[model samples]
Target: MRKSFIYALLVGIMVAWGLNVTALKILVDHFAPVTLTALRIFTAGVVVLLFLWGSGQLRKVSWNEAKQIGVAALFSVVAHHFFLSVGLTRTTAANAGLILGLVPLVTSLLAMMFLRHRLTVFRLLGIASGFCGVVFVVANGDGGLGHLSVGDVYVFLAVLAQGISFIMIKKATVEARVMTGWMLVFGSVWLFVLSLVLEPGGVSSLKDGTPSLWMIFLASAVVATALGHMFYNQAVQHLGPAESAVFINLNPLFSLLGAYWFLDETITLGQLVGFLFIVAGVVLGSGGLDDMSARFRRAKVAAGGRKVGM
Candidate 1:
């Protein structure tokens, strides 16, 4: 019961993570890519620092732990978020999130190589399905991309960067303590510098008033960036990213839902198909029919003497 509950929470976090794509897109007019990303990481870092201080774990991180977290910050939070945010600025978040769903497949491959995780057939198929879905998105649901828009290509690169990060997170979260706090602090500082370098008007832009300007930044900082990644980090520690990667499938789903609420975007059949492909990929990556069947049995047992009442 507790496991299921935690799983649901993880799924919720991933949904928020997915929804953040649209939220950032809405905010892009207010801040440049680096600016918003810097804000995102900095806010999350501050919150996380306060959290560590409160928990009394701030002083517990060793120097070796610091280095691991630093690497995690550079790859997962700094590099990945910068690339993805900049890419999301160019493409619709709807398209970007769907494409980024390929992260699991990429993570799976990287895990096999570096982490010594075995590559199961199911995961391979999921990876393939994810690529197929990407093709559909690029092709506009016809078959494949006829020609690449610079924006589309950038978005795809974002997907690759993020996918690699996911794999790294799976490993770092496994062995490295203070992974979350280190990532938050270092990533925030790096991003803030990047924002300063890239943004023409710099912090002065924050004073410009659109109705949701600060609200957008705050929500992204508090809800989407901090809370979302916090939940994800915990889930990785608890669930191992192999199972947890399935939670990422919720991203595109939440992207659509959030867009409907915030941007009044219409959902389309092609996107729906894209969603299915991602789901298919995740299911495959999750270890296929045999693995899912076993999970069902476990969940059923974990449900206890009660029949789950579902």
Candidate 2:
């Protein structure tokens, strides 16, 4: 796919993800975190399965692939959503979006350690800057780092879990589309169990939930989880992970805008600073800035060569 079109598509996907966070904040107000998580997972799983079947790509997983999918479910779907939903209840959606933006940095570190990918000095510095941004938010005495809320900790851990899952999935034999479906199915089961044990009334909350809540639930599941992941996986396949990941840096901006527009949330100065640092870190760490510069240089050289020949 053309780079411009890919970036534009990614922008749309990230915007959906950002808006989903705002919707999540609203959902938590009406539904218990685990209950919401379970419902979304169930909805997403069903959608993904239908898509796979429609595309003639659905197939039964091997035993080994099932095991890998189960493991991925634990880290990616179950743990990530459990903590993220809980965290959204405690923190602003804007904050959660910015913190989650650290995902690429976390994923890179995990890739370096587990997949034996080499880390350059630029990447290490970028990683450190990203951490500093996290600390800036987490350590803010008024709910930042020094006085970390349980919510902040949970969200951070969710990021870690998701990062680890990214590495684990790379080792799995199942195709991304199939793997996503299975992960949602397995994770939904675990989430349902957790909901029953922990969330009072569990699935019964849906009975009492507002129509708006259910609408948001469908949007979150269908738009953000099912379609967003499908679009993202396709982008990764076409552009490779590094280029595909560059769009993630825009997530915080999209989230902040959505939060302000939908939730009337205000952006703090500290949050703005943290956003810059995190975005810069992501660009440097992911080599996105370097990649663009190289492309520009090549384009310039090509134009110069053409002019000279003419």
How accurate locally is residue 302 in candidate 2, as Cα lDDT from 0 to 100? Answer: 100
Question: Model 1: how far is 251 from its true place, Å?
Answer: 1.5
Q: Candidates' lDDT values, in order?
A: 0.71, 0.87
> lDDT per residue, candidate 2, 39-93, as tens digits?
8998999999999999999999899999999999999999999999999888888
What are the per-residue Cα lDDT tens digits for candidate 1 across 1-310? 2789888898778777777878787777566777767777778778876776787766656676666677777777777777777776666667777777777666666667777866777777877887777766666622336664455677667666666665665555333335665677788798888787788776777667477677777877888777776777677778775577667777778887876787776666777787788779877865545467778999889787566555
Model 1 spans with C-alpha error above 4 angstroms: 141-144, 170-177, 288-310
Candidate 2 lDDT at 217 equals 88
Residues forming the 10-long window of minimal summed lDDT in candidate 2: 137-146
Question: What are the models' TM-scores?
Answer: 0.84, 0.92
- Compared with the true structure, model 1 gives a TM-score of 0.84
Q: How many clashing residue pairs are found in candidate 1? A: 0
